[model samples]
Target chain A: PQNNKSVHCHHPCKNIHVFQKVAGIVIGKSDVKSFPDRKNIGVDRFTFSFTVKDSPDFFINVTAWGNDGYINLLSGSFSVGDCVVIENPLVATKDPEKGERFCPTTPSHYRLLVTEAHSQVYLCADIDTMDRLLPLIHLPVKDSRDFYSLGDIVANGQKLDGTVINVLAAVKSIGEPKQFTTSDRRKGQRLEVKLFDDSVSSLPLVCWDREAIQLVQTLIPKETVLFIADVKISFDSFRNSMAATVNSKTIITVNPDTREASLLFSYAKEASESGALDQDEKPEDAKTIINIVMFLDSITDVYTVTQLKEKAQENPEAFFGITYSFISKLDLDSSVSKVIRTRCTRCKLQVMEETQSCPNQLCPGRDQAFSASTGFDLLVDFTDHTGTVHGCALRSPMAEQALGCTTNEFTMLTDDQRTAMKWKFLLERCKIYVKILPSTKMRTGIRGVILACTRADPGEVKQHMSALLQRL
Target chain B: RQTQETLTKKPAVENSLRILTAVIDGMRHWSQFKDKVPYLFEIFATLDSAVTVGRHGAKNFLMRDGKEVVQCVFYENEQELPRLIRGQVHRCVGNYDRSTDVLVCVSVRPGLPSELRNAQEAVKACDAEMRVLVKSISEV
Candidate 1:
């Protein structure tokens, strides 16, 4: 029998094997975590985990265990997104309580364990020769001390809309990075870090570059002060405010050894101690808040449609949230045109003029006969006390659930029957889960899809409102 | 024996339309009967379906399962057509053309193969509705 391991692992769980060497790009690295050893009482044990992926679909969690100094040294040697090679590691089955509690959920059934005596980690030395490999961020533009206060940027928001400037501020909070695929199937990631200074309470600084997101991922919220040099300033007309973008010309210095940065850092620590900073919005606080509410499993960060609009404008990253609103407009009673569309089974594109091939020029099955299925494509309006959102997409299978019928059944209903069905949801309050996307081309300034739509339970609504009030 | 009756009536195309609905809508797959209805059918095992609109605006498609392949034809009732999901078993209900073995659809929708045994009423209702549509098309 051949003993060679295949690139596609059949099932890593079946056998425990020692990997001589494995190389992958580090996607995430966590801070060094320590716990008091239960068996040793007086002694402490330290461990840190990082995730590496050789391909887009597969990534494995690797943890190193050693004394405080050794674990710190190993973790600090490589930043996220670096191509790193692990030598002589044991592949062990994962413990759900220990592994998944802190680390990301992975498809691999087993994780790599790195120990002090048996394993070593190295940054791939061959990376430079492979120039096509992801590029390292340029070193923070060699110590330019000049910077702008958050207050200054806001005061001159219009004038600095298109200019480059340095900003010095303490991290108020950092949001989880949002990963999305563009229409062309290209992957993109965005992270938003909220910054605050003595002059300004809060300003969103966005990180769109991959390396930039990884760098900001390591910063401790409210403890680290950033000196961002040559960052682009853009005036957001949607929010009627200003925001900064980190780009190629920008270099971020974490905890810069400067008098101003040090001063802001101390101020941040003081503000956090005094309870002046609102910590409720942070994901870390969600666990305790969840325990108190007890019914928060289905709900996440609830917002009124008006607040929802502001939230989308505040950060470029996409987010999911629930809103209580009325179905102000549902076009079921109108002409039954375009409500049901035939999509080419091969490419899933709309077939316009009844061709026998996919409309997509590059579709794999373009030369084959075109097969299509019809489904509901609906546009609806959601209104709350704050405001109304126009043209929110309510598409199939969710649309089928809300209307209580299949596409075949819907087409059979007369206009009067459709109108009667529409009236049932038209003015009634509904609890709608929506995925909001900041859209520039839309007249409403924001676009969204209704993930779920159903009638709101009055008692549940009251209870949810009280929870929000208690938090406030 | 049943295919012979269908062949004889194939020449009276206008009569089939005038009597539709009942004549075509009530028509079942030949495999389903020992007696002849107004039409014939060819059932396929694998699903290879396509819907195309011709120059005069008639929409048609082919249904092919590996065991056999059959054609279905229609016109203007695009809204009435069920969205055929790929990879699911589907059937076309139309009078069979013995010469071409085409299922000129009368638009009857059968419940999926799994549900067909229990969905006789739903199928009956569907056949009635499509019969009206075919009758109107013939008048046009």
Candidate 2:
């Protein structure tokens, strides 16, 4: 049995067996370059180099269209004397005469294609040649200072890529005429961007039309790391390097759809150090329950978000908390367990809990029930303000029965008891007002109300609260 | 009147004219009363801006500032009605309680009669269109 120990991995590589069958490693690096094809193919031979542990140094030849526009992208003038970590590169065969070739392992002539390369171009030593680059491993870039003098692309004779950049600009409303012109003249158009940062000087950044334009438009603000790919920056008409414009063919994209927080987990390190037996075993069910507890605890602890605006600002974290709780609860009960009690697929009648055979006579779904949990019966019980209920949750005909002469008639009742549990529980802890909606699935003449809870600003708890409330 | 007669037509030109007429009617009512009275046009538009144009025209009233808005009906649709408009940049013509089905008149705007005719036509077309979508569905 082949194990991952055989391959020397510098970066996180999971499911090594899955990659074994793959011909070439699907790389996430953006070391694309376009140069004029002086050797004859009428296209520039683009070279992209990346590295992997135990695997031979790999390079990919990219054919970039060389127009007067790609002149900036073609000029690879960065001084490369820095140590770098090239991820998951595979050695691919290449020929000076041929456009494409198959992957061969017998010391064939090939170019090195790097996957997800992380590098600082001007580090302590010159590590470009693959032979001399074996021993030294580059460290992670920590701050803005670490990128200083990391000579790669000289934007106006200076390093302009590693700036702590922040931009506040509206979606540029470009007319159809200008939109048409980019496809006609440059093969890519530009957006007039107004950029800003805490730095003393700001300038227009003429971004190549490929990736950067999309990045500027789609990227949600407050992203920790910006993975920019295939973009060439020129001083814009405003002469501000910060005021950038994206041209066509210049691609600006990132590794992940990075809107939310990205928490990297090193499970390999955990499993290796903690013990493989623990890793191999299914996780304990309490893990999810504990997460739910933690989420509820976090929301209760938040005292600062008193106003709706403040609460709305904290809504993301609040929703994240709710999500973690709900997901944890969901994880506790597998789908198989949920279907322990079945219902009829057609008439929607309750069947046996273990087997989905309905006991109802003359019912279409009788003796052909699906699952107990599959039955659309709602169970609601009135709970005190503390969210602890007084009576047990009902099922069947009893669950469908309405309330009889209660002091809290105004308290809303929902169709689903679990949904009510979540709402009432949250409402009890906070000032959120919720009204349960009537369900068509529910039997007629049944009125349900779990309890009364005050209303909070909808905008504040809106994200965390289930959309079910809206439907109700 | 000519525009109102062509409300059910699918031509973009007619549609735009009908929409414009509805807006003009809503604007007229919007300009009339000083006490911020809620008009019938505003009430219908509050329920569904794109529903029956007659209803929408009736519902299509305005608040003080000019951006278009209608009352959010949570009770009828079983949806959560937005209580407070997040930003105060725009004014609301009416406030609706999803549970109580109560509509409170917040502001007023007088509109032109020509716009009312346009709104009426647009609404009639919308109702007919809904009937078509509903007619196509076969019950299981």
* Candidate lDDT values, in order: 0.63, 0.28
- The runs of at least 3 residues in candidate 1 whose Cα sits more than 4 Å from the true structure, single-residue gaps closed, are A1-298, A344-349, A352-355, A360-372, A464-472, B1-140
Say which candidate scores most in DockQ: 2
Give the local distance difference test score of model 1.
0.63
lDDT of 2 by residue, B11-85 (tens): 221110001112323434323421222222222232223221224223222222235543332231212223332
CAPRI quality band, candidate 1: incorrect
Residue A169 of model 1: what lDDT? 87
> How do the predictions measure up, each by TM-score?
0.32, 0.21
After TM-score superposition, the amount by which residue A32's alpha carbon in candidate 1 deviates from its true location, in angstroms, is 34
Q: Candidate 2 falls in which docking quality class?
A: incorrect
Q: Which stretches of candidate 2 lie above 4 Å from their native place?
A: A1-28, A31-131, A143-281, A288-306, A309-472, B1-140
TM-score quality measure for candidate 1? 0.32
Lowest lDDT sum, 10 consecutive residues, model 1 chain A, at A287-296
Q: Residue by residue across B35-121, what tens digits does model 1's lDDT show?
A: 222223213223466667776666677665444566667654423565665555554434566566556664434324533232233
Q: Weakest 10 consecutive residues, lDDT, candidate 1 chain B?
A: B13-22
Using TM-score as the measure, the top candidate is 1
